[model samples]
Target: MAIGYLGPEGTFTHAAARELRPGADLVALTTQAQAIALVEDGSIEGAVVPVDNTVNGVVLPTWDALLGTTASRIVADTLVPVTFNAYALTGDVVPEVVVSHPHALAQCARYVSSLGVPSRAASSTAEACASLAPGEVAIAAPVCAELYPVATIATKVEDGAGAITQFGVVSRDDVRPTTDRWTTVFAALPERNAPGSLAALLTPLASLGCNLENIVARPLRGSVDYVFLLFVTDLDQDREASALDSLRAQCSGLSVLGRLAAAKHSRPDGASGIPARLAPVRS
Candidate 1:
């Protein structure tokens, strides 16, 4: 099976794709949108796109793409624990400027600011690593040093060690219910100027005993309307069905992106325990 990922090769999304399906054919596209487009058009089985990062929050472009598409749904997800480093073509010279993807720059803001040099955005961290000049540094993964003719001048340059990025594998079909640890849903509330309208939409989830993991509101393009992305956990089969039925009645538009089992190895503590929602039931 062929899977697509945001690339020119050597991106974190590419790494996540490999992690999700080892030994599968991987197609690299220039942007997350392009990868998603391929999956939506049936050109590829699935595509891995970064949805959220610990340091920078949601990836806006990917969020927008998810909202804009109707044929695609998130089928699986993997968390990539990231720690960036500064790479340079030559270690001897002080870098006059730095380059990396916008997210990388944001992740290592403190380190980048400390260098007191201008920074430029590249399509990906790997591309930035490959494009560096003698006095230019790239904030990239340590693997970039091996992939390109770059030296790791600085290591662990991110603001914190617990920097994790969440990548979603989007496909044309919805994922079947598994050991449901997380359910990702997107909904468009009826456009009303009333202050309590958003809260009213969320009331059903609470009543159904669904625990919300995260919620993000994005303004629809060219309109005052908004769409909400929600991650809910600790929902059993009954609650899941109930929540969706209630949501459908309340929302102008609703999509159940995926019901997924959390990645075991993706946990920050490196433990292989099951997520709380998927814990063994007591007799």
Candidate 2:
């Protein structure tokens, strides 16, 4: 099966893909949209993409893409720890521009500042490596330092190796969870953003005893609307319909983004075999 992931080999996303669903034929694609598009179009059997990171919060456009992808269902979830490197031609001139994804640049902001290197964004981390010219560095996984002759310095530059990003196993077919998991997505805005309206909006979940894990409140840029995300403990058959009702009533002004499955997650460690947990923050 061809599986899609945020790539060039050696990227943290690729690392997560290897750990979660190893030996699947890997599809190196550009944006998260592009990756999901492949699945929608039947170009790939499944795809893995980053949903969140500890230090940086959400991956932005990816959030929108996940909501927008057609008939895509996240079958599984896993965490991948990121370790970035300053990759250039071995013993060659230092690079002025480092081609990488915007998320990679933010994850390694301090490194970029230390090296005084500017960055470029690509569809995928792997695609960025493919586009790099000679003498330019790429702040990506050393495994991603392809195009032959590129070198990597300063491995694991992210401040939080403890930091982890969430990825979804996407396919149109329903794949039941193999273990405990949770599902999160934006529901709706029942009303325009107003004084204390959002909190007043979510009072129903508490009433239903539907323990919410996190709530993301974002104002749609240049609009009076808002997007509210509820990261609740995974629901089962008895609770699914009622939970959907609660979501609809609570955020009547909001549009219905699919209530996809999410699993409880933690950061992975080599010895303990459990990923460290971040303090309860809005996912």
Candidate 3:
């Protein structure tokens, strides 16, 4: 299988892509939009794209890209832990010249503040680590040591290893099993601005026993409407209408952004990427 992930490699999305497919062929793209486009155009069978980070909240740009697409998705998420670190080139341990992905920098804001280092943003952690010299410097993961000619000055710099990210496996069509499947999508409701309009439309969903796994509002820059990324769990072909009806009666400007077909991604026998007790989470 061909897999696409946001990368220059050594990014969490890159890690997720490899973990999800094991030995599958992987392609790395720069931005979330690029990853989604690869799937939309059939260049790859699926993509590993960040949906949200525990500390950074929702990645709006990614959500927007998914919302804008007609692409289908996999419900199973690759939950990876985020632990930002400082990487330096060999003997280059100047705290003032730190380099890293902007998101990484933001996630470890406290550590950065304590160090009071001036950081330069890079596209990926590997790239950032590559730009540095070892000695008195470090990066988030020791897994990056193979790519960059640097040494880690510290590990797990971010307070509490609780920070995590959940990524969506984007595909061209629904690829989940009918049993235990959950569907997710982005939609825009008409009359989103009208008072009680959204509630009136969604009230029936509660009555119909639709359990929402997620419901997030996204800001639309050029329009007054808000986009909704809704994840409905326990979906069957027989029950598609109740969800659709909820959209129609309570919402006017409704549009399906994308759909996700999910099932529990099983752990491979003898696989040991992360411990079950400390399975990474979206903090």
Candidate 4:
């Protein structure tokens, strides 16, 4: 089977892809949109891409792409722990500039700030490592130091050791739910905005006894309107069908983004036993 991912290699997405389907043929696309496009075009069977980061929050591009695409659906979800390291070419002089992907830079903001140098965004952390000059530094995965000719100057630079990112495996086929604790759907609310509109849409889930996991809203393109993406659980075939019926009645458009097994990681203190990273959005 062939899979696509955002890359130049040495990216966290690449790591996630490998973990998702080890030994599968992997295609590296320059952008997340390109990876999804390949899946849409049937150039590849699926694509693994980051959707959210523990510290950096939602990845806007992936969310926007999910909202816009119709040919692909999320097949599985995975959480990869992240640790960033600052690397530089061998030199006695301190680096004058730092570079990395925006998310990586954000995760290591404190360390980057301590460097007291200007920072620039790269297409990917690997790309940044590949292009670094003698007096420049790249914040990237520890593996980058070996993949590219750089030395690790700092380690575990992320804000916390708990740093993790949520990745989705996207394919053209609908995946059957493997566990009761599975499934997430994306729905677009009606164009007309009014009081309690959001609540009305969510009422069905509550009525059906479905646990609303994560809920995020993104502004519709070139408009003041907004659309919500929801992750839900505690649903069976009958309940899922009923919930969809209610949502279809209330929404302008509805799409089952994906349905698969949920992640196994969970916080010991969490009441729902859901992974802290996947915990439901509370009011």
The candidate maximizing lDDT is 4
lDDT of model 3 at position 77? 63
lDDT of each: 0.79, 0.66, 0.66, 0.81
What is the Cα-based lDDT of residue 60 in candidate 1?
79
Top model number, TM-score: 4
Backbone N/Cα/C clashes per model: 0, 18, 20, 1
Full-model lDDT, candidate 2: 0.66
Question: Candidate 3 — which residues are off by over 4 angstroms?
Answer: 133-139, 177-183, 211-213, 233-240, 253-283
Please give the distance, in angstroms, between residue 249's alpha carbon in candidate 1 and its true position after superposition. Answer: 1.8
1-283: candidate 4 lDDT, tens digit per residue: 6898888789888999999988989988888788888888888899998887866777878767766688688878888888898888874649799999999998888888998999999999999998998789999988887788888888888765667788889889877667766666665565367888888888988988888877888887788878888777767778778888878888887878766465635433343535788987899
Candidate 3, residues 129-175, lDDT tens digits: the string is 65554323434455786666666666677755566777777777655
The digit string of per-residue lDDT tens for model 1 on 170-278 reads 8888665466456656555644747877787789889877887778888877888787887777765677778778777777778776554553234455554466999
Off by over 4 Å in 4: 91-93, 264-283
Worst 10 residues of 1 by lDDT: 263-272
Ranking by TM-score: 4, 1, 3, 2
lDDT of 1: 0.79
Model 2, span 1-283: residue lDDT tens: 6998876666667777787688988877666788888887888998887776665676665656656665675667776656676666664657678677777777777777777766777665555666777767676766775544566655777544565677777777766554443454544565545777666656766666667766776666798676776665565544645666766665654432333454434544433333458444566
